[model samples]
Target: MNSNRPGVLILSHCGFSFLEDLKEQLQRRQLRCFVLTSLPLAEHVPARLEQIQVWADRLYTADSHQLKLEDVNNALQTLHKSGEQVTCCISVWEGYRHLMAAANAALGTYDIDAQQALALRNKLNVRNQLADAGLSQARAHALTAPVLQTLQAQSARYFIKPIHGIASYAAFPLREDTTWKALETLRLASVEDTVYASAFNDGLQFMAEDYIAGQEFSFETLLIDGQAHVVAIHEKYEVTETADTVLEDSCTTPPASLDQAQIAAGLQWLEKVLTCMALRWGCYHIEARFTGQHWDLIEINPRVGGSLISHSVEAVTHGHSMLSLWLDLLLASQDDHAPRDALAQQLNAFQWQADGISAQSVATFFRVYFAQPGTLSSVALNELPLAPTVKHILLKAGDVIPAHAREVFLGQLLWAFDRSRQAEELERLAHLSATALDIRYEPGTP
Candidate 1:
C-alpha cells in the first residue's frame, strides 16, 4: 500500500496455487504484488486461502465465478482512490487474458490489444485467420445443427472442441458415426455446472476442424516487442484420448523424435506463424503436429504451458522459469527504449546450459496421471524404482472427483536423464511408475 512502490496487478480465475513462489521473485525486485481473482472465497481450501492472504500485498475477490472488464475497472478505480500506482497487469490464466488486456489498457500499460486477445479466444477465428494466410493446414467450421448433418456425411475425420475452452474440456474426435445428440449430451454433462464452466466465457459454441494426424509437440516461445524467441520445444511422448477430451500423459524436452535439421526448420515455420497471427509480445504455448516433412497448427495458448512445463524449461535453461522471464518482460515494458532493448538482447541470447549440464547432454521428462470420476479413497506411490526429481500429489483421500470427465490430475512425476539414455530410461521408468503407483476410489461411485 506504499504510494512510492510500483505495484503489479494480477488477474486470476479459480486460484493461483503458486503465489508464494511468484511473490518471492517479485519481492526480490522491489515490486508490490496485488491479486484480483473471480474465485469465490468460500470455494478455496482453508489452508491455501490463508497462504494467499499472507503472501499478496492486497487481495480482491469477486462474488462471481467469471471475471469481467467492469470488475477489473472497479478494482482499478479503488486503487487510484487510495493513491496507489499499479504500473502493469498480468495473468497466466488463458480465460482471463482479455480482462488483463482491458486492465492494462485502462492503466496505459503494455499488453496484447483487446481485439487480438478476443480473437485468440475463438478457435474458428484463429484457424480461419491463419488458414487464409497459408500458415495453417486445417480447415474449420462452426458446429451448428444444420451443419452437423453435412459434417457427418463428409469422409474426413474431425476434431470437436469448444471455441473458448481450457484443460481440454469437451474435446474429442468425431467419426462418421458421431451424432449431434451425443455431442450435446457430452457438452451438458461436462461443462454445465462444472468447475470448468467459467472457462467458456464467450458461450458454449463448438467447432469441428479437420484432424491433423502426426506426432504432437509444443513450442514454448517468448516474444519481445514483435520478435519471437524459442525457449524450448516439448515432444508429447504419450497422448491418450478419453471419452470427452484428449490427455497428454508424458512429455520430454528437446524432442527425441525430431532431428536437428527438422527442429531448425520447425523454428523457422513457427516464426512465420506467430507473425501472421499478430502476436507481438507475451509468453505463448503453441501446440502443433509434425507430419515428417512439415508442421501443422493445433492451437496457440497465450500463456505458459501448464503442468510442469515451466519447471522442465527452468531446469534446462539456467534456472530461468517462464514465469520469472515473463515478469521481467512486463517490468521492462515500462522502461525507456535503451533498457528494454538491452533486456531483450539478454533474453535472446539465452542458452540451454545450467550448472555444468549442457542441453545436448541433459534431458528432462515428466509424467502426469489422471483418475476416473468418483470419490477418491486413497492415492499413493508404494515404491519408486527410479527416483524422480519432483513429485506432486494433487488429490487426497475423501476428495470427491467431479463428474465432468475432464483431466482430473492425480499426481505428476518429473525426472532428469542423460540424453543418450533418455528414450530407454523414459520407457522403463514410465512402466515402473505406473505399476508402483496406487489409486483407489470409494466403492459404488462413478
Candidate 2:
C-alpha cells in the first residue's frame, strides 16, 4: 500500500476471526487498516472496536451506534471532520448493509451518494434498475394487495421477500393459494406491534417476483472500482424456512453437476446485471435460478453473503480464502483477475453430496451418524478415524436442537479435499455429514 493512501475502514459486526484473517492478508500486502464501529441493531454495540483497532494496525474510535439516518449523518460528519483521510468503507456485516452504506456516504468515503445508497438498500429501486436495463429476470413489483392478488392468480410460483432483510430473512415462497394466503397473513403481521413482525418495516417494502424454478446457486465477488471480480461461487444446497416463519420442513442445496457451457452462461448473466446496475466498487452476491438452459435472476445483494458463506466455501474447497482475496482487491487489486481469462466458465458452485439440514439439527445428528454410519451414508460408522476433514463439528449429545429440516438444518459440516481426490472424497464426507446429523422437525424429531 502507498504510505500516502488513507487507512482502509472496515465496517464489521459479528465478532470472529474474519477480521484477523483479513489483517494477516493486508499485512502481507503492507496495507494499513482501521476498524470503524457501527451498531447492527438497537443492541449492536461495538464491543470490540478497540480490540479490532489494535489488530488493524491503525485506530479510529467512534464508539456510538447508529440507528436512524440522522445517527448515520452524525457518525459520518465526525469521520469527515477528523484530519485523517478516508480510503474506502467495506460492508462485511451480515445484515447491516444499509447502516454500513449510510456511514460510508456521511463521511464521503467513496463516490456513492446518499440517493444511490438508498437505491442499493431498497428493493423497489433494484426492481426499477432491472426493468430499465431490460435484464432478463422474474417479473417483480412493489405491490398493493389487489395487485398482489392479481399477479398471484397468474403466476405458478412466486417469491415474497423483504426489500432490506439480512440472512434471507422473511423470504416467502408462494406456490399454492394456501401459501399465497399465508403470505398475506405474514404481510399483515408486519404491521402488527408484536415480535412476529417482518424485520423490514420502516422504509422496507416487500417484493413479489415470479418464482424462477431450477437449481439455486450463489456467487460472491468483490466489485473493485466498479467491475465485478469473481471471488467464490457456492453450489447452494438449500434455501429453507430458517429465516421465514412463513413455512417449515422445506429447504436444501442439491448437487451441482455442471457443463462448461452452462457455467459460462451463468457468468455472463452476472456480468450483464452488474453492468446495468451501475455499481462501481464493493462486494456483491448474485442468486440466479436456471431452467433447462435459460436462467432467471433471483436477487443480487450489493454486499457479501451472510453466514460466513464465502469464507466457509473457501475453507472447504481450496486452501485459498475468499475473504483474503476480497481484502487484497480492496487494498491493492491483482492485475490479471481481469475478465479475459483463458479458463472457460469456471466450475464454481458444485454440491457433492446429500443436502444440508438447517443449522438447528447439526449437533445431535452429527454425533449419531459419526458414531454409526448407516444412518447417514452406507459406510459403517466404525470404519474410519477422525481426521482433518472435520472443521468444527457442532453435533454433540443432549443439545436442544430438533431434527426438523427447517431454518437451522443439520449444523453446517464444511470440509475440504485435496485436488487429486477432491471430487470423490468430498462427496463421501458430505454423505457422512448428512448421516451423522439426522433430521427431526419436532423436538427429538430426527
Candidate 3:
C-alpha cells in the first residue's frame, strides 16, 4: 500500500453519531479517512467540524442534496492533484450506498452491482427480484388507485409502506375490510416527510405486500464477491402492534429463540438472495421472517445495520468491529498483490465463528417512543439492577412532540446485559415504561 494513498473515502449524507466512532476506530488502525458529504456546508457543517477536523485528512462537500458523479470524480482528481489517493470508499447509510458503489466503480478499486443498488432501495423492486429468483414466498402489488380500490373491496390482508423507507417509518399493516377507511385516514405526505435528507423526488409510492406472520430476524452480514458471510443474527422486538402500525422497540443479538437448524436455514437464504442480487462487496443488514415450515424476506439493505446493532456487535464480540472489517475489504480491493486472493484470504481470517460471540453476554437496544403529542415535560427512567453501557437521550424536557400517525420514538437506550438477567431486564423495562418512566406532556393542538 502506498503511504501517500488515501485509506478510505467516506460518503456521508447525514450526521449519524456512529460515524464519528467508526472514523476514530479506522483512524486508530493508521488508516486515513477522506470525507465527501452532500450535506449543505453552511447549516450542517459547523456541528461536525470537530469530527471532520479530528478524523478526516481531507473533506469535500457537494452543494446539492444529491451526490453527483461528476462531483465525486472532481474530488478524486483534486485528491490526486494534492498527491493523495483514495484506495476504498464506504458509507453505512442506506441512501448513500448507491453513491458509494458508484464511486467505487469509478475508482476501479472494487465492483458493485449498480443495478442492484437501485433495485434494493425500492421495496417493490426488491420483492420482484426475490420472486424472480425464487427466493421469496410473499406476493407484492404496487399501491395504485385501482389496486387500492380493489383491495378495499376484497378480503385480503397485506402490509403497505413507502417504496423507499427506513426505521419502519410510514409502514402499516392493511386489512382488506378496512382498506378504504385506512386510505381515507392515512395522511398523504411526500418525500419531504422523510426523516433523513435525500435527493429522491419519486413522490411517495406505496406497496401492498403480503404480510408474512412469523418471527422476524435480521442477519447482519458482509458480502465479498457476492459471497455472504453471516456476522450475527438479531431478534427484532416490536412495540405492541396496533391495527395500522408496527414500530421497533428493541433488537437483541444471537437470536436466542432460533435453533441452530433455523439459523443455518436463514444464512442459506441470505446467501442465495445476496447472490441473486449480485451484491459483490459491502455490508448488508437483511431482515427476514420465518414460519415453522417456510421463510419470507422482509427486506434486504445493502448497508450496515442501523440503530445500535453495530455497537451491540462489538459489545457482544469483545471488540471485533464489523465496520473495520468492511473497510478492510474496501482497502483489499485496491491491493497490488493478489487482489482477489487477498480479499479471499482476509475473509477467511475474519470469518464469523458460530461461537465467536459470547453466550453469557446479551446486547440489546431499546427505542423510546412517546404516546401523546405535546410539549415534553419530563422523562425519567426506572432504576435497573444492571446499568446500561450507553444512554442516548434524544429529547429534552421542553421539546415539542408533534403528533404522528405512526409511532415515533424520542430517544434510545443501549444495554449489554447478562444472559441470566435478560428476561428480568425486559420485564423491568416494560413495567418502567408503564410506571417509572414518567413522560409528562403539556397538551397542545396536534
Q: For this target, which candidate reaches the highest TM-score against the unseen true structure?
A: 1
Question: How well does candidate 3 score on lDDT at residue 253?
Answer: 65
**What is candidate 1's local distance difference test score?**
0.78
TM-score of each: 0.92, 0.66, 0.84
RMSD of each: 3.0, 8.8, 3.9
lDDT measured at residue 104 in model 1 versus the true structure, 0 to 100: 77
Better of 1 and 2 by TM-score: 1
Score candidate 2 by lDDT: 0.49
Give the per-residue lDDT of model 3 (tens digit) for 1-446: 23654567777764452568668766777777778876544544667655576657888877765676677778878877777767767887677667678878878877465666777888888898788888887778988778888776766677887687665655788764545445444535333344342523255557888778888888777776666667667788654566555766666766756777777677677777877876767777888988877778998887777666777766665665667656666776764647656656655543444433324255454545545567887776667654567665656788765545556566666667666666766666555434435566766535
Give candidate 3 misplaced runs (Cα > 4 Å).
1-5, 40-55, 176-188, 194-201, 240-245, 335-374, 377-382, 401-409, 418-446
Instruction: State the lDDT at 439 in candidate 2.
Output: 35
Residue lDDT tens for model 1, 1-446: 46589788888775563555577767888888888877644556565556678878777877676788888998889888877889888888787888888887788767788778878878888988888888888889999877878988877788989888888888888866668887778667655653567677645678999888999999888888888777778999889987678999999987878876777777878888888888888778999999887888888988788888877877666577777777777777764777568767766555322221124456788889887878989988777767787788889999887667478888988888777898798778768766556889999876
Model 1 Cα shift for residue 85 (angstroms): 3.0
Q: What local lDDT does model 2 show for residue 32?
A: 62
**lDDT score at residue 55, model 2, on the 0-100 scale:** 68
- In model 3, what lDDT does residue 67 have? 70
lDDT of 2 at 158: 65
**Model 1 deviation from native, Cα RMSD in Å:** 3.0
